[model samples]
Target: MKGRESGMPEEDYWQSFFDADGVVETLFDAAGVAGDLVEFGCGYGTFTLPAARCTRGVVTALDIEPLMVARVRQKAEAQALHNVRAEIRDFVSQGTGLVSATQSHAMIFNLLHLEQPLALLREAHRTLHCGGTVAVMHWRSDVPTPRGPSLDIRPRPEQCQAWLYAVGFTDIRQVDVQAFSPYHFALLATR
Candidate 1:
């Protein structure tokens, strides 16, 4: 549940937090998704729309917020996208379609800050297909900053790298994404 105090319209305010198109552009161009694909913390089709444009496989866009799911569904319908599907499921508590039926790849943006980054990484590892890429996007500094500088608590690139390692993610790579203004960073952790 997105607490009312969060002070943002679930999509209008929250979707603006990231340059989803830019990040998804990077992922698509980088050959990030090699198999079944999904996105964690997908809000309002921000990243989901672009991701849907690129991949031929099914793209399961997930979020914990039901309103966010509805908003994303509206956007997807407005855009006439048939490939992307929105669902409400906690990334850790529910199936991510990463491990259950089969292993899958995922792009997790701006989600790790919600809970322990290490636990998410471990779950990502468990659900992802072999050689899957888990893209983690967050801010560059944990200190007070302009972008996503929330008590909601986001991690810097260094912390993401270290956490990925701690969670047993191999071949960790951090990249600066210029798509999101105010400078957002993304880490690619593969198993």
Candidate 2:
């Protein structure tokens, strides 16, 4: 149950397209996220490392790609970040394997464009504690991005909000992340 291909460029090339610090900062700020966090599709540890450093609790990063998981684990180890748990997991099929009502926040970065977006959003809702946050980001449909899924499949912010609402999330608000990456937009939803 691996997600659809991200259509990303090489690691360095894809990483070069984003201001990682700015994106991570804006995401956490918009979500009011703290405590334990779960990140889905943490490719190349772009956001995972910063999140591990920022949170007092653990940051569990899950990816279907073993290479991606290993890269994140390597970065966490190099940084001596004991709070990170980078595991190769097909959460899309097996679920998060995290206890319900346990995680304070869930991150679905660059992944909502998958074939089963609602299913993933439902999983995010289930994993979070009451009043917990669900942060989602995708390539902005309005602009041409250096690399991302086709525009026909890329979700708009409003569509994401509607899906979150359908999954029992509330307080859904758009976060202005254009400063971080002009091609991306983000939203924060509460469960």
lDDT winner:
2
> What are the Cα lDDT values of the candidates?
0.69, 0.87
**Model 2: how far residue 104 lies from native, Å:** 0.6
Weakest 10 consecutive residues of candidate 1 by summed lDDT: 1-10
Overall local distance difference test of candidate 1 = 0.69
Q: Runs in model 2 with CA error above 4 Å?
A: none
* lDDT assessment of candidate 2: 0.87
- Which stretch of 10 consecutive residues in model 2 shows the poorest summed lDDT? 1-10
Cα deviation at 34, candidate 1, in Å, is 3.3
RMSD values, in order shown: 3.0, 1.1
TM-score (C-alpha, index-matched) for candidate 2: 0.96
- Which lDDT tens digits does candidate 1 get at residues 115-155? 55566677778777677777887655634545464654656
Question: In model 2, what are the clashing residue pairs, if there are any?
Answer: none
